[model samples]
Target: MTLAETLQTKLGEWKPAGDGRHSWAETFADSGWAVRIEADRTDTLGCQVWEVALDRVGQADASLTLSAWADRIAASVTGLPEKLKVVEIDQHQSAALLRSDTPGSRGNDVLYFEVRLAGLAKASIRRFKSEHAIGARREQIPFIITHEGLAKVVGDIAG
Candidate 1:
């Protein structure tokens, strides 16, 4: 099966978290396994948030590691918008770190940026919004891809 088709099929078996804050999805390919297309909304430090995670399995001797996939994914996502400036890039044994500056958050007050994951066949993306705090209005913004989305993107690249 194609990668996208496999992903769609895997997504169907997901189970929701009891708190209504998270869900898990899974998929299997001829060689690899993908898991946890988690989606959720919540509040953090008075800020609205959302998140998603996608992970891959079976990497005993794969040619493309998660970290390499993350690098390609980062390049793809960052290329989406010029305003999304990459702030930091780091990598560990099996993971990659990406920090970026987003557009203004909360009615042009504070801006939003996130540190997303982009290594490992299984990846995730999380988002964050920060208000300027100087007469700025509070906004119920979506979750920033802090780590979850990065994981998925990396997986996509590797696949």
Candidate 2:
């Protein structure tokens, strides 16, 4: 199944918000409800970054990021609900990498990239983890590299 299809089947009833700005899919299982939101971007290394945000019944929100690779795509599932563990797997279903420790409230949750060209090596994924103890606490966010997209913006620097 395609990435979108796999997500839709697992999440259910995916509806495009509009203009490819964002889309949402939802499903309910024995555990509770799972909602996945997909946002599109014209930036990066000619690749589309998919952000999968999941929320369970009476639980905190968690998210994962996946992107196309040179040969295959990589996916990392993190921010699991309390007592839950983080899982990472490659396209082959084999264990590529894993991190069980709970991530900070703000920072990169997961990141994947496929660099078919030699220029991507010089590029870097700039990330920041923010926290607001004053009023409302913010959550972690990630920014990935895309080909012919945002990555192109820094191609000269990368080269």
Assess every candidate by TM-score: 0.53, 0.26
Find the candidate with the highest TM-score and give its number.
1
Model 2 C-alpha lDDT per residue in residues 67-94, reported as the tens digit of each score: 1211121122211211112244344532
Residue 13, candidate 1: Cα error in Å is 8.5
lDDT of 1 by residue, 1-159 (tens): 555445444444443445655654555555365655445532221212354455556663557654555455556654222234344445554445554544554564554544354555445555544566565564433543423333334345445
Using lDDT, give the best candidate's number. 1
* Root-mean-square deviation per candidate: 7.3, 15.8
